[model samples]
Target: MGKVRGELRSHCPINFGIEIFGDRWTLLVLRDLLLQGKRRFGDFQASEEGISSNILAERLDRLTHYGLVTAERVAGDRRQIRYEPTEAGRALLPVLVEMAYWGARHDPRTAAPKSFALAYEADRAGLLRSVEAGTNPSEG
Candidate 1:
């Protein structure tokens, strides 16, 4: 069955987000946009997980439709498109940070920095601020 853009399984707050980005690939796409400084289709395709082109297209479309991402054509290159995280998407920083922190702490093979948890624990707000500052906003 085909799903509508922005469609949700329920009105529950938690369910709302889960419905939009419950899939691992979708979340990874968001991670790329929000945390990894990725902007092009090719960049996402080259992700560590090696997502296929088809799924990447679908997830990008879904994120754009859900207002978590914005796709815009760059100047001087009408054929090139760049994806950026929206304010709504940037709002997920804390969530991503927590998830990263958990993984770093629990996953023995985690590539996250050894001091990540400590630095995050010492100044969570500062960490969030830095990430927010670094996030590239959509161009006008």
Candidate 2:
């Protein structure tokens, strides 16, 4: 049900990237991974947007196939798996942050966090850095 690149396709990185994440829900899932560190099914389902289980499963599998997310079995729980963002996935945080900021500005009543709005107003780079720090605490 999605577009596939043909052998005759030209090389446009943005187009290629869009093919991977141009869907309505994919980016939202990526946002959850990047912003909230959501790794399990329940965490994703608990999102205010309410994604269905089947769709979440499919999205997680797709993201894993695309190398954006890596799913590994939880230790001592063979039936459970945890999904985490790969480095490629973390690279999309800026885009999500920008989109959130734009949504907040266009709609005064947007329900995004006040901290995000304040950070957007002051310095998005700082916010991104903080997120990166949170994700990689060992770097310090």
- Across residues 57-124, which tens digit of lDDT does each residue of candidate 1 receive? 88888888888889999899988789999889888888987898889889999888766777777777
lDDT of 2 by residue, 5-44 (tens): 3343445988767767878788889988888788887898
Candidate 1 runs further than 4 Å off: 1-6, 135-140
Q: Could you tell me every candidate's TM-score relative to the true structure?
A: 0.89, 0.83
Candidate 2 global CA lDDT score: 0.78
Q: What's the CA error at residue 76 for candidate 1, in Å? A: 2.0
Best-performing candidate as measured by lDDT? 1
Q: Which stretches of candidate 2 lie over 4 Å from their true place?
A: 1-10, 135-140
